[model samples]
Target chain A: MPDWQELVRQRLSGLALDPSEKEEVHVELAAHLEESYEALLKENVPEQAAVSAALFQVTDWQDLQRRICAAKKRGHIMKKRLHQLWIPGFLTMGLSIVFLVTLQKLGFNARIVSWRDSDIFFYAPWLVSLPFLGALGAYISSRAGGSRGTALLASIFPALALTLTFLLMFPIDMIIEPIIGRQADFKIVAAALLKDGIGWMLFPGVALLAGGLLAHVLLSLRPSSRETAIG
Target chain B: MIGSGIKRGTAELAVLSVLHDGPLHGYELARRIEQQTNGALRFTLAALYPMLYRMEQQRWIRGTWETSANGRRRRCYRLTPAGKKKLTPLQREWAELFHALQRLTKVSHA
Candidate 1:
């Protein structure tokens, strides 16, 4: 009888699977062939006929190999994308929160409220860091097979979070205003909020756009041979 | 021989129905499916294994290694709760499809 395990390993050699995964497939195929061969022999079949019958089950090994490798590659890419994009994005957001808390502890809030000449100084630090954070998110997303839209969205995660928080807090602030019996210029507060929101997002948005353009240039310059050759 | 398109569509239902009763290794599953269908539905290893792996990935079925009485190790596949949940709807769809085909063909059931 032919060495079924060796035959299975040879047939599966073209697959791009990891070594352990390939070995598992090899064992499964070999075991399948062995069982089929034994079952045929039990029915009084000759050894040569049994071997042929067992091998006949794998009618198109090439097609099988192609499909298996394609599936494995897709799985690998998805896993890589999840790790590369989401993990770093969340970490960056967490670090930004810590930086804000540190600023508050350093009495930055008291200085901002006492502003006599300029309001921009209150947000200068955040503005300076926003572009780098956006660039980091865009770079990670680009490296993980994300499109331009994905890169932009990833970089704007902090903005999205801040907007969502403000939306949720707006109702509570309105309810507490009458209870506190404090009336301030609503128009001025609204203007400042709008201005600050725009200021906070301006650098990050520009950075994301620049990062996306840079990614596009870098990608187009690379050779196309790295892409999958098979359909 | 069954056409590849129809075979592919029905393969999942057939495997799930057979495995609903108990777990079976690859060889035994093939043998039982062929035997039960009177050779009408046959699965080549190349076609069957890939589908099995895909379903395993989907959490529809789980495969575990077990040693037979003869001390030979085999990977036996059993239907999961998820697979069982999906089986009823799949069977219903196939029945509906069969009825539609029968109606269109104007052929009475044999």
Candidate 2:
């Protein structure tokens, strides 16, 4: 009754949302206002009072505009994160997993070396393949305007994932031992973790991260890739 | 009347609970909440829409355009699987708070 659509458009104007998104908000708000106004009218309220009461629902139009605009903009940020970090990270992770599986299937036994009384195991083929996977992740992330940190992170996803798994394993095992009626010796567990982690997590993580960092540094040198970079 | 401060904390629960029934457009959704609370709780247009948008972005709820029986087009919102999953923890927390408050108030009144 109060030309609610026009009122909404005028009040919510200058929002930094896409044209279609702004229109969608305008229509929804106008409909809500219209519903309120009509419901008030049905209760024998005068036209002017109904309009006034309906409009009073929003105390600060400026704040409303800011909030709606910010909410819609955050949706865009999620999309950007998907492309810049998640997609690249997953792709690199998948590639490395595939490479590792192939090497295992080919009977490429992990070469064992005695390092500081630890039987350190290294899959030669998979370890060699990491530099390329790291490069792929870093290159893809930077091209998509990822920040230096995310690009580095994407490149070393596999190592990080392995490290995360190892870290979780310690806690999970500790929890389960008590549940399964066994006493977990904390000192023994820590010593075993330290000895095993040096071989399984630290060495591979460093190698993979080094490859990723090298590619990230090379990409950072290019001015075009640096322009849209965000952390 | 419930204060905005109190409502702000429970708004997600209110919206998600009301929407758990089925999809409803913005106006109907607001009306349902107020009705369920005996008009003690009302959502202003300013407060409701932004929270709705934020929740949709979070993937807790999904919105879609629909033409109702009266042929008015509006964006209908429905609870997602994620929203349903979130409801259990929220309900548990609120129940625990209510019990704690009841205990404190009884002690104070004594």
| Most accurate candidate by TM-score | 1
What C-alpha root-mean-square deviation, in Å, does candidate 2 show against the real structure?
A: 6.4
Cα-based TM-score, every candidate? 0.67, 0.62
lDDT of 2 by residue, A1-231 (tens): 678999999998887776888899999999999999999999999999999999999999999999987877788888878888899889988998898889889988788888777687667778888888888888888888788888888888877787676566678777878797886665465556566775666766676677878888777788876675544
In model 2, where do residues sit more than 4 Å from their true spots?
A: A89-231
- Please state the interface RMSD for every predicted structure, separated by commas: 1.8, 0.6
All candidates' lDDT scores? 0.73, 0.85
Q: Model 1 over residues A1-231: C-alpha lDDT tens digits?
A: 778889999988877776888887788889899888988999999999999999998888898888777655665666755755575466556656676677778866522433345463245565555556666675566666566566656666676666665555556667767887885454455556656655444544454445445544555456661121111
Model 1 has a DockQ score of: 0.36
- Candidate topping DockQ: 2
At residue A158, give the lDDT of candidate 1.
70
* Model 1 spans > 4 angstroms off: A72-77, A98-102, A109-231, B107-110
Under CAPRI classification, how is model 1 graded? acceptable
